[model samples]
Target: DAGVTQSPTHLIKTRGQHVTLRCSPISGHKSVSWYQQVLGQGPQFIFQYYEKEERGRGNFPDRFSARQFPNYSSELNVNALLLGDSALYLCASSTNSQGRYEQYFGPGTRLTVT
Candidate 1:
């Protein structure tokens, strides 16, 4: 079966622009999450959606948001892009939110701010 998949793979934008990253979870998965990974740092959890509801969020600003669909796919939207926002946006999927199951991650969407 296919794992989590992200679109565009790469993106470029200027400061103050808006960007949307997409993800499609594996088959039969119900929970989707988003993360941001900056160079030399670990991945930071951004949002987690279960059954189309927001379950968790990190310390990111209001400009970051995400949503899951009925099919378990998701989209992460970042507004007012900044140089600091340039990083790899990763999407992960799991069978549940209890952390009992292993989560699978996508290759990630690389965002670059010029």
Candidate 2:
């Protein structure tokens, strides 16, 4: 099977603009997560959708949002972009069978807000 995959490997946006990043999970996975990684810092968890319902969220502002599809794919959307939003948007996939979840991450989409 394949690992998680992200689209538009790179992106650029401006302040006040909106952007969307896409993700596809590994086959048979039922959960997906979004993360943001800034330079010199660890990745910060953003959102997690299990079975198409939001299961978790981080301290991000309301400008950040995400959704999962019935096929297990997912999307991360950001509105009213700010320079601080520029970072590598990562997508991860996992499965929870016995209260344990392991995640596989994609390379990430690099978004630069100008």
Candidate 3:
């Protein structure tokens, strides 16, 4: 089956513009999460959804938001973008069967705000 998929492998925007990134999880999986990775930094959790419910979120401003669909797909929406928002937006998916969960990441959507 297909792994995680994200759109617009890269992105560029100006300050204050809104951007929405999309993600589709692997087949038969029900957990998806969004993360932001800056230069030389690790991916920081933004939001996590499981079974169509919000499971967790990260230390981000109100400008960051996300949602998960019934088909296990997800979207990350950032509004009133700022310079600090420039980073690689990653989408991760995993199954809910094992005791430990390992995420499978997409290539990421690089958001650059100038």
Model 1 spans with C-alpha error above 4 angstroms:
97-99
Q: Write the per-residue lDDT of candidate 2 for residues 39-92, one digit (tens) a residue.
A: 999999999999999999999999999999999999999999999999999999
> Model 3: C-alpha RMSD to truth?
0.8
Compose the digit string of candidate 1's lDDT tens values, residues 1-114: 988999979999999999999999999988999999999999999999999999999999999999888888999999999999999999999986574878899999999999
Error of 2 at 73 (Å): 0.4
What is the Cα-based TM-score of model 1?
A: 0.96
Local accuracy by lDDT, each model: 0.94, 0.95, 0.93
Q: How accurate is candidate 3 locally (lDDT)?
A: 0.93
RMSD of each: 1.2, 1.0, 0.8
lDDT score, candidate 3, position 71? 95
